[model samples]
Target: MPKGVYLRRAGRFAWLAFAGALLATPVYAQKRTATPQKAVQQQPAALTIPSDPDDAFVALREAARKNDADRAAAISATLVDYPIPSYVEYFRIKSQMFDSSGQPLIDTPDAEISAFLQRYQGEAIADRMRNDWLLVLGKKRDWANFDVQYPQFVLKDDTQVECYALLSRALKGQNVAADARAMLVDPRYYGDGCVDLISYMAQSQQIQRGDVAFQARQALEQNYTTLAGKIAAALPDARVDGDSLATVVKMARNDPSQAAAYMGTISGNLSRDEQGAAWGVIGQFAAKKLMPEAAGYYRRQMDLGGNQWLSDESQEWRVRAALRQGDWKQVRQSIESMRPELRAKDPAWTYWYARALKADGRGSDAQQQFQSIAGQFNFYGQLASEELGNRITIPTRTTVSDAEAMAMRSRAGFTRAKKFYDLNLRFEGNREWNWELRGMNDRDLLAAAEYARKIELLDRTVNTSDRTKAEHDFTQRFPMPYRDIMQRATDDVGLDMAWAYGLIRQESRFIMNARSSAGAHGLMQVMPATAKYVARKIGMTDFSPSMMGDPNINIMLGTNYMSMVLTDLDSSWTLASAGYNAGPGRPKAWRTSLSRPVEGAIFAETIPFTETRNYVKNVLSNATYYAALMSGRPQSLKDRLGMVAPSAVTTTSLP
Candidate 1:
């Protein structure tokens, strides 16, 4: 063929081939692209699962949260081979042992619960289950099982369970009246188990009508009519139901000018003891409001019978009222009138009682009392130290040998505690650690703390050493972790490093990943929103939310925030510490309410919020010790506290 013709024929074949390829491209592309897209879409779920156990655990948790026992049982059944298998196994057993409602599967309760306790025996969950079982046994009034299980219940602090134990004792012809009376102080806290015990006591005449009426008065303090009614139901002639006591108490507290009317109302209708209690309530309200007339009211109640205002609550109010009015005579009288156990429980009252003696010209007796509590690491203890002309300084500690340390770890309690920590049950671990050391002498506890420190369980080390009554090991009590970062933060913000350390110790106990129920995070427990606001304010843009647990960023933000609060709080660490805990507004409000300058110790004791009150005292007291340790000299806690008084002006600005 000619060359041109051949070339044209080749071009024609090429066009045909190109057209064919174009026709095939979409199908080929669809086949290739669809495979990757489908896999990518599937990858999200698949990628989330690192392994079969992880995937199964995620599903198990979701089911557990929903209380979907059936699904959980199915998922957890095959997870027996996983690490931490006990937790997974619990889900399976829990599914059958508890219904979807979390109440025990009533039909099959006995053997499975026993098996669980026998299997998980010293584990935290076992005791928790025992708590549930005891409640169930008590509800059933199966006294034999309740007794059997009650002795094994390690967390005996459960008031309801305590009540149940009392109920069991009552079943055996024993009078639990004194125990019942002591625990009845907080009537508003009665749950079903406790209320049942109260009913049992009332039916057996173990709880008197007067006791019922007294508790009713306590209920009235909270405006908890339901609690009052519960008491009234148990004792028909108790006279609580007819008093409308909550109404009278609220009226007295909120509108004190009508206190006269309420006072008359109580005396008019209530029984003798109830009337005395009513007067005590009025005295409490009056005292808190700084009414000078409160002393006369308390005196009138005292005249009814010595036991009328004999309660811890009533007598504390008497002391507070006297303290408020500067009546040194009544301060002494009221302090002496307090129950011996009550006075011994709080050093503040002891310190003040000594001061009262000193004011009344009994110098020798005052010195003796102040010297007794002089070395305590608390607000009153520090104040008492100042009264004795001493400052809080580093304590001499007996060092532990390696053999002693090894022996401490070999102890059953320490070994059990380490196991619980390994399981990440910190509460259980700490409880076990402390529980085992309950009866140890000071040196043994220090040895135990050394063991905890050896294992890097820093919190237990501090806590164990803190339990000593006659010994003070400052190094063990306040170990400085992340000291370099903390120092940098203190330097940067011009804040006291000791104070910052003290706050962090209280806030998180130096747990790097500590979080609070209020969503605070890190060692200082700053809230995320607060952290971001702080970050923006200080030009701190070098971190993200994940860095909240970072020692540097957390310390930086915490110290800066603390510095801001310190300035706005008149440079008093007492007020600043309170502000850091509760908020800036509350401390300012609390100070402005003071009619005159008060001793810093008085200011701390008078804080309305119990949590904030304790937080302030503890932070300042801790800083005092830390200061002594850091500077190698005795530090004046009084200088740290200075004086808390009404602000010169109502300052509301905060950083």
Candidate 2:
């Protein structure tokens, strides 16, 4: 075959090969006329092969296979003319390269691979190609970089596990045993396999055989219980001996109240390790809900100094039980007894300690404790602040008479209902539309009515189908102070006022004292540590966690943090919203690594988290409606708040 002709032939063959078969196909011919006068001659109709791009590619494949260079070239040319469907483009590109005999090219240059990845960025094909490149690179150090950079790309198979294991071993050099154990515990590799693998390997003394038992033990402690029972069942038998059995019996006896029944039933003939495991099972059971039983076993294990390894685990269980039962005094004592190093590193402990202090009426001390944390404040601070009588404040933009507010509310109400009507029209066939409307009817109608009342208080008139009833309901539930705070914060942060209201609504449902499980506090759910940092930056001295409960402080800090996150994330509200819900660092990293700019809608849809995705939609939609209500003008919330440009004011001082 001619050198250049092979390329064309290869391209065509790729287009034709499909569904496990290579078939010969006839090529459509274009007719030509010698002159315009002679061109009156009739031509054959164009062959209407399947219009799908995949069919076109298959046709191209058949032509290349037959070494029909002209047909292949024509097909390749044709394929390029159509839209490259996301799925088949990879196969199409590969089929384009050919060797001298018109065979598909075997090896492609790294640069070509990189270029291909860039061209098809965000597609699954790009991920596969990138993984292949990383494997080819085969540098141990690069594996982590590759994993972190392309988490969505890595192949999840045995090969992936082995590759990570090898990389871990190589990185650890002299401590391959530890590395292997670590790899097995890593969520990416071991997943549910870690629990059984650790138990089995430990019983067999595999780490001891490799002179890395200590390191292996560390890995086992962190991940063993995370494995599922199904995977654990497949583990190798645990070695049990007489001495181990005796130790287990003794451990069981130490927590007599909890494990006494289990101890009585265990076979006396069992070896020491078997008894130990039996006791472990008893401990596990107690940990679930029978804390008394678990505590007994843990105490026995603690007394047996030889099993000091279980000390930390026992204490953790005890602490958990105490917290579960809301034993504030016990929680305080347990946290105080814990090593300062551990308490400092674990946010949970710190938060609980602060909570305990607050519950004990040491409010001042609790506030100080909450204030000390920088990044790790969680729900504890929120609870502490609320108990201390702190309420977030929203500053009013302008004083308006009740009549003015009522008039504004009427106008906004008309716009909102109409928008919903229009949206229903646009998405008449969409189930999601129906779902949204249903949800609005179930709950948001009341919230919207309340918002309308606030607008009405500002002398706004909202004309709608059920204006009288809505007005009555709104008047009953509307809180002027809260609405004022939301409006002021929105203006201060240069955010759309409606967006701020929407965020507050979704975050805390307008409950000034609401606290989330993740430690977000107040109406705006400002994290305590975040609040402290903002407070310090704003030159507020003697700042206390109690202040976070204050409406003004909460709004100020939450808005400031929102502004900071928005600035850091390229001003994209979608990413900023993600950061707000899931922390700023993760979304920022995701945004930086994305090869293609995500469309706002598609980005929200593709968000890996269900909570964050819904949050973005709710926040944006709420903002849109709020803006319509507040401004008395129909405008897109996304356009106004989607990407904020930095203001001329660079200082921390509030406007």
Candidate 3:
């Protein structure tokens, strides 16, 4: 979800007035529906042999919307002789993905599917069509087709396709045990396909008796108690009954250690694995609470062998609590016990490990670790650079030659992506651009991004630049496209331009027309109601809905409100960011219990709303990076965070 997405949801009903008080909204190409498509009335009996392409296109969409496949197909047939836009092709493909009866349209000729893919090679809708086609193929047990198409699946984030791939592999007598373990741990992604894969693996001896309990522990640690119970029920050798699991869960809710002690009552009867799993779940409860006794609770159970999942989580939160209490020694010990593979990738734990090393008089070793992760982008990565006694620095920009730029621009995918942008179809444009970069090396990616910059596609340029790993181009990464507008907004509101930039980057990735699913509008994702209120408050004349996506209007209104919240929260950017995201009411309530000033970092970690906590971190961290880019000097994240103090009571909900 985009930042402030939920905030704008309720305000979507606000009337959007176009030019001269005309209430109009653009109609988007939605996914196919089950209802039958409806045809338009004939233009005139004699005049209408067939409407022109544009007129035919409108009728086609209506037919598609009505789920009248036959009529839509007829209209789409007329489009064959006309020069239709890419979206017309998209609707044609979508209508074929699913029929009006709500069943996936399988048995379509493979040649036709292949032809569509070839025609829309670089379009976002192409991948969507291919995904649906692959699903149909997989269902029909056409392994040869599935195998050929699976590799071309650019965004392989689809768990069902992954599961189907595994199934295909297993049927071909391939070993997918390692892949299954990595992919199946998260219950959230499980669907009909993944579940079937799991069931097949279980029956095939790939899932052992021990693996069952391990999965149960994995489920429990993630707070999916029902999934955990299901795992336990399925395990043939489990000693613990359903009733005991319930009793233990209730106990764990109060104090994790208490739950651990209760496990002792059945210690003699339960297996070692069961004991470990129960203890692991208990530790999760304790670590999450960050109770004073959390460290001891995990420390005493260090030798327990349980689900590898729970062990990792238990250690992570133990370190989190230890860090909060300034217990460097315990933090080091907890991280040291973590799996090497997990520890190697986690920057947070690595940073803490370096801190522990420094505290223990091993500055040389700490510096070595810090040096490896420095210059990277992310919360912990920046912190690591600070520990190594260096500040964030922008990378030198590379010039793109005319020949190289032409070569990049000539690519079919990039051209299609650019076309989408020009048509104001940003969503489709972004998808197409991202898909085209799937196989490009870092240098190629940089070149493509430079080409995007040359074309003034600032949003795509920024996003494309983010894909580079071997190179860092801060100019492209933290672009200041609407510099003049932002300057005025910040200057008038007396707020930090870098901070505003940071918020906008996270809010909409600098897309001028970005609209979230929750109905947030424009670059800053301002709610309609909030925009209206701010418009009136600032005494702006002729405020209208047509101005939502206008970069100047959005930045001015957003920055002004930012200043308002900053002042309301006693100049705390941390709280202001949270207020901006989750609303000012929650932050005010969250601050009421602050008996004394607390570190912004600690308060952020403890924020009950996961989205707001993450939003605050991202905004502040981004601001830090932007500050480095703008000032050409190091900036302190600590100074930016400052200390958050309790708020004074105010009559108004939002300032």
**lDDT to native, each model:** 0.72, 0.46, 0.69
Candidate 3: tens digits of C-alpha lDDT, residues 369-407: 888788678766777887776776666766556676568
Between prediction 2 and prediction 3, the one with superior lDDT is 3
Tell me the spans in candidate 1 whose CA falls farther than 4 Å from its real position. Answer: 1-76, 79-108, 118-126, 187-189, 223-225, 237-241, 256-261, 264-266, 285-300, 303-314, 401-425, 435-444, 454-456, 469-472, 541-545
* Model 3 TM-score relative to the real fold: 0.77
Q: For model 1, how does the per-residue alpha-carbon lDDT over 1-655 read when each residue is reduced to its tens digit? A: 1224213334423434422432342211111123554455344443243247757765675565554555666678768777555556555555444444454333434687798889988876677678777765665455777788999998787777888799778756689988887776665556556665676566667777666666666666757777666656667564653555545566767765476466674566655655565566677777666566777777776666545324466678888777766678988988887777678888988899999999999999999999888877777888898898887877787677778877986676677668667656577567667767867998898888888888888888888889888776789898888899999889988999999988988898887777889899989999888788789889977757888978888999899999988888889898899988988888787666666888777777767666987898888888988888899988888888888877746555553
Pairs clashing in candidate 1? none
Candidate 2, residues 179-230, lDDT tens digits: the string is 4543442333443123323332333344442222222322233333323222
| Model 3 Cα shift for residue 441 (angstroms) | 5.4
> How high is the lDDT of residue 538 in model 3?
95
Pick the winner on lDDT between candidates 1 and 3.
1
Model 2 TM-score relative to the real fold: 0.34
TM-score per candidate, in order? 0.81, 0.34, 0.77
Better of 2 and 3 by TM-score: 3
Residue 499 in model 1: lDDT: 95
Q: Would you give me the overall lDDT of model 3?
A: 0.69
